[model samples]
Target: MYYPGQEAQLRAAMAESEAFRQQIEANHARGPAEPSAAPAGSTADSSSGASGGVQTQECPRCHGSGQCNGCEGTGHKDVTDAVSGQMGEKKYSSEMCRTCGGSGKCQLCGGKGRTLPIW
Candidate 1:
């Protein structure tokens, strides 16, 4: 059940989640934030400050690619079904990935390939 650096990775992920939650709470307490005006002559884009002043990061779960992890981007995966009354017996079947719903997108990022701090 243990892998190298798994504990550290889990702790880091937990800390990141906690920090994100706190940021959301603080933003909510301060009321709706006004979007800052983009600099003159600057191109408006999603990666720019024009994105409502909210910063986005590559999705940690999908690494910003939006590829389905469960099915390895194939939109299908092999599933093992347990047989009733048969010890250690199993049935193998290939089916659509529940995580991505057969769309071959990251479940966590909702296929955006990136994640915003917004709730």
Candidate 2:
């Protein structure tokens, strides 16, 4: 919430914004989080692949957090819907991110969320 007329609300909002910024900085300094295990319904996106072998790497995009740069880690994206029968473009819609394959993981790392050595 923002209120230019209300000084108190504005101050509170500023403080909250500052706190959030600090938190984000801290998170970045610590680096992206690692995946301890697998994702739902897909071994290929997990620590193990279809062959049952470990397939992981530090996400270059998310620094090993398994988030897609295209969607900022969100597996889905909000898009403007097509025009209706009468109306023009409609509201936003969500769909799986093609880059990350809806797993919010680094395709290179197989969503393991671990930064590995370069080959």
Candidate 3:
């Protein structure tokens, strides 16, 4: 805990990291979610393996990058594990992101950078 003279440096790094985390969260909250289904007569893009061309518009979530916002393109995330009943809940660790399967891609797009539609 005692860096002798690196206190300022450490604090600055921590602040920067927190700011970055906040930015990622804010960006994630500002996007248009993918639609559930197509308009009825639409068809899926078999060639692209997309949702039969049901997408009405680009997903605001990843801007069509299909990258997962949770891991920020890192394909990994930090998580907490429960060790025991009461105290177990306090335990924590980092692991591969289940959302993107360590691929850092969006769930809806499946790393294809797009979404599917249904009728």
RMSD of 1: 17.2
Q: On TM-score, who's better, 1 or 3?
A: 1
How high is each candidate's TM-score? 0.42, 0.35, 0.36
CA lDDT of each candidate?
A: 0.66, 0.59, 0.62
Candidate 1 structure, TM-score to reference = 0.42
- The prediction achieving the highest TM-score against the true structure is 1
Better of 1 and 3 by lDDT: 1
lDDT of 2 by residue, 13-89 (tens): 89999999999777656643454444422223333333334434445656656666666666776455555544454
**Which pairs clash (backbone N, Cα, C closer than 3 Å) in model 2?**
58-114, 58-115, 58-116, 59-64, 66-104, 66-105, 66-106
Please give the lDDT score at residue 27 for candidate 2.
66
- Candidate 3 lDDT (Cα, 0 to 1): 0.62
lDDT of 2 at 83: 50
lDDT of 1 at 2: 62
lDDT of 1 by residue, 83-116 (tens): 4766655443467778788887898878777675
Task: Please state every model's RMSD to the true fold in angstroms.
Answer: 17.2, 18.2, 21.3
Which residue pairs in candidate 3 collide? 37-118, 38-118, 43-52, 44-52, 45-52, 66-106, 80-92, 83-88, 84-88
Under the 3 Å rule for N, CA and C atoms, how many clashes does model 1 have?
0
